[model samples]
Target: MDATKMAAVGLSASYGRGPAITDINLEFGPNSATAIIGPSGCGKSTFIRCLNRMHETAPRATVTGKVFLDGEDIYEQDPTAVRRRIGMVFQRPNPFATMTIFDNVAAALRFNGRHSREETDKIVYESLQAAALWEEVKDHLFAGATSLSGGQQQRLCIARALAAQPEVLLMDEPCSALDPISTAKVEDLIFTLKRTYTVIIVTHNMQQAARVADRTAFFYLGKLIEVNDTKEIFERPKEKLTEGYVSGRFG
Candidate 1:
């Protein structure tokens, strides 16, 4: 599948008071993985939220500039549709407490008004396979989502996101809370995800960024400092601020 093209032009966002991101501009290509890295409160999460129009969901939040998906401004389109096409997986695994594993992935299908049992089953199975969870959960399709381990639950969330067939996946610290093994699994899944979906990840772990991202964008104080290939960003950053942060001089 050809990757979807997306860009944010002169984007700035505020929470009814101060700007969280300022005059930010960036472009993303299909089937590419870009990592947004910075310290806490540097707007890494906020920027990705704006990409899919989720930032506006906050109370009294305000946004300026345009986010384009396939050359059309997303802010001018239905927010729900924008989100479905650009799915987000959060830092924590937040599976539906009451739903079974199958139901969790199926929820997305149901929301889109797809009701055929045969098709739903097929989609659910395929999505689980895509998420790299089918082998682990195939026998327990009806198990409660909460019954899974932290890692399994996170993959389940990824499966849920995949069921919608999003062209882009915005993962905000998706593995921060998991153990090393689980984190590795999610990282591997990310590499596979970018083969067909555009991936934008916000992570404080620079090493993780290097492992998964094709290109890395560095942000500081709500502004983009430098962006380049992951190796260049770490070995030869052009901006002093980026150099300091990546070199462990300051975070």
Candidate 2:
């Protein structure tokens, strides 16, 4: 197995004193893919956000326990710096409608103090290519990002995340808004991406999780019920709850 890139030790989180998830422990390996799978409202998204310190963005949201990146406590460090190294992509394509595609991809690099225009341009193009969007949008770099299709917009958001060159990428249902074909494209991208960056995705689609993840974790009512290799989780789950959920008996 690859070295651990991220780990949660007894992680617990809540909204306004109401616990959303508790005692969650998991480790994500470098250059590997892990998927958090469960029904809606199972705290899967909350868990991923906690990994990158984004859980604090919500009013009244609080997190306890430890999140370690390369064995360093992330919460003890600067949240801004943690986010820069652990990028995220949301369920919808959140491109800035007012900005052009090029600007959208360049925003993070600029914010992080990449001042040279030549370097910014090079990073933007390279990141887009890494996200598999460059060939399609290369000629329209300055077009309004919103002018693209939903699939293209999602890919653009991915490119924007990649621009930061994060060591770990946390995605919350990244392909939820895309069509089947677009979802397939993103799935392929995720598979290929594990060769370069660790990926943890929260997905409700069982087939999607099975298709792209090396490991799958099942959460229920704020508790992780089981976690194991994808084949074991889907084909021969160890726990009754895991088997029921994966076999479509119940969510």
Candidate 3:
């Protein structure tokens, strides 16, 4: 599949009364990974939620400015279509407890539209493989999704997103609840997945950002402080705020 480019122009979002992120401008290239990092409540999650219109789902939530997918304004498109094209995995691994692994992966495609059982199965298999969870679960596709370990469950969520065939994938702190081993596995998966999908991840782990992202963006108090190649952002940040935060001086 061809990769997609995403651009944010003067983008801002607010929940009810106050702004979470303001006047954010950034561009993400196709087939690459960009990590958004900051302290808690820094609006990194809110910024990614706006990329696919997920922010609007919150009651009284509002957004200003524009987010573009391949030069087209995302806000001008159908929300459902936008979501289908730009998929998200949350901070927690949330596989439906009632559904089997196969069904969990197939749910996205089935919800989008009708598909032959054969086609659904094919996609389910491919997505699991893409997520690096197939070999572990192929023999028990019918097993409940929650029966798997946390790491496996998170990969299942990733597979669910892949089943949508999204051009861009947004992950909001996907490793926060995972163990070191599980986190490493997901980090490896991120490296592989970026070969086809444009990946934007929100993470608090700066070392993880350095490991997975080609570029890094730092946000603080809802404002973008700096953006650059991961090495430069960590090794030679231009902004004192960024340097201080990265050096453990302050959040």
Whole-model lDDT values for every prediction: 0.93, 0.93, 0.95
- Model 3, 146-197: lDDT tens digits are 9999999999999999999999999999999999999999999999999899
Which structure is stronger by lDDT: 1 or 2?
Answer: 1
Once fitted onto the true fold, the runs of candidate 3 whose alpha carbons sit more than 4 angstroms away are 1-4
Residue pairs with backbone overlap in model 1: none
Error of 3 at 167 (Å): 0.2
Give lDDT tens digits, candidate 2, residues 115-171. Answer: 698999899989999889999999999999999999989999999999988999999
- TM per candidate comes to 0.97, 0.98, 0.97
Residue 180 lDDT, candidate 2, scale 0-100: 96
Winning model by TM-score: 2
Error of model 2, residue 64, in angstroms: 0.3
Local accuracy of candidate 1 as per-residue lDDT tens digits, 147-239: 999999999999999999899999999999999999999999999999999999999999999999999999998999998889999999999
- Candidate 1 Cα deviation (angstroms), residue 132: 1.0
